[model samples]
Target: MNVISDQRVRRGRKFGQVLDGARKVFMRDGFERASVDDIAREAGVSKATIYAYFPDKQLLFLEVARGECLRQTEEAEAMVTAEVPVRTALTIAAERIVAFQLSDFGQRMFRIVVGEGERFPGLGRQFHDFGPGLIHARLVHHLGSYVAQGALRIDDLDLAADQFAQLCKASIHEKLIFSMTETITPELARRSVHGAVDMFLARYGVGG
Candidate 1:
């Protein structure tokens, strides 16, 4: 038992190292230009080691993207729940989403998907399913709870979630995507989130 456990632990560590190396290479070279040789060298492991963990480059990239999405979703999970008031909850969620979207890692992943998704269809689908799709589903669930509680009067939770998300990003998402602006501060997130919450509530709040 001990021997098997130790082998599993070692394998997990090796896999983590390979992922780190692959992420760096992909970020630097983009998907089309990056090679398995570079990933193995960067990981300080043999090419066979990388291949052992990931059958192909596409799978490796998908794993990286999945990790990124998981990180965001895990962090935001606490913010979107039934206990919090609808306005406050939406504000918190919006702020975090804006901050993540403006982050360097987020931008890099977005660019990678946009650039390579056509050539590799799975890349885009993987990101969408794990990232935005997950977020949208969670948001709908949270909003549905609010509708039940009569806090908001949303008839279409999915559409409402999409609109709210768009509102949160409307102010700066394009600029960040285009590299027209490089810095996003906490204050910026707060301002953007507040505006989104206010607008969303005005449209969907119970009284409105």
Candidate 2:
């Protein structure tokens, strides 16, 4: 009768608590040193409970990081529409994504992935495949409409999206994730986003 599964009914808070705990443990101990037992104890759950939600310790941490990526990815996908216009949507979407990815937690996760993922390659691929590649696909799909509507020239929409993502990365992720630069201001965010969109539109926008 209670076959709905132990992980579901109250999983909302439990999973969230576990994820939060895991982020801290992972951040403190590093992936190799952080233990599932410690994570479950910190989250006030049994080790089996952690197993119910995540296959392994790294996976548990991966889920936490991936959830953050998904939040940003969903926000990026929200900008696509026939009415918003491709360039405008890209600028706004990029601004939001860049902010999320460059935030403090995002930076830590980035560092962890870059530092540890060399040995645990799947973890790195997981973030890259879903977080960035998926966002780029949606961008290309939306930008394709502009080409059809005669606002942009004929070419690969996916390639265009890749270029747009690169532009955003140049403005924010490159500095935050790669360079370990200082924090960026909202004003700087807007300026960077606008300039990237301007360059993109200039390349493909029909008139010039």
Candidate 3:
């Protein structure tokens, strides 16, 4: 690549360091309490450098939040494609998603998006595009293939796609996020997977 492209890449990497530090500070300190100065100090960059990348603390927070969402979605998509049993693939994806969203990082991200979304218009859309949007698309593509091969019965591909994802990821996930639930043991994760698959099959499986 040319020098200008190289410089841009380097700058992006450096700014990414600031964004990473900002996520930690915001999560630990909350968005209102986190200062741009603190984020800069944590990232080992000057406040001016932070400003160059992000106009203010809120923007910095959103950038980090967006990156996290995109990252987790990519990870989830990858997890879904490994050559495991379809049930097992769905099970592991659900567990990883649960862990990603229920962790301190995840809760902080959820709060940020819900609280400040009006102030930042695209935060939700970025997530919708990469987070659930990408996952739903992938599920439909793969599961639709199964339908074509006579492995599953999916008359409404789009709706079934949405259901497959919601079923796989939503059960324990909803409880953990909204219900002040405690830890999810491996046994619970496994049980959630098995239970969700059985119920989903009963409703959507070809033989049913």
User: What TM-score, computed on C-alpha atoms, does each candidate reach?
Assistant: 0.84, 0.79, 0.73
Best by TM-score: 1
How many Å off is the CA of 26 in candidate 3? 2.2
Tell me how far the alpha carbon of residue 197 in candidate 2 is from the true structure, in angstroms, after superposition.
0.4
Which 10-residue span in candidate 3 carries the lowest summed lDDT? 1-10
**Which ranges in model 3 have alpha carbons more than 4 Å from their true place?**
1-11, 56-59, 79-84, 118-126, 169-171, 178-180
* RMSD of each candidate relative to the true structure: 6.2, 5.6, 5.8
Clashes of 2: 0
- Please list the residue runs of candidate 2 whose C-alpha ends up more than 4 Å from where it truly belongs after superposition: 1-13, 27-29, 171-174, 177-180
Candidate 2's error at 125, in angstroms? 1.6
lDDT of 3: 0.66
lDDT of 1 at 20: 91
The pairs that clash in candidate 3 are none
> Residue by residue across 1-208, what tens digits does model 2's lDDT show?
0112113322444788888888888877777788988888888888888877775565566567667777776766665567876667767777866776667776777777778777775777766664566666666766777788887884877777878777766667666755656777787787778877888888888775
Candidate 1 lDDT over residue span 1-208, tens digit each:
0111111222455998898999999989998899999999999999989877776677777677767767787787766666888777887788777877877777888898898877876667767776778788878988888899999998889899999989988768887877677776778777888999999999999875
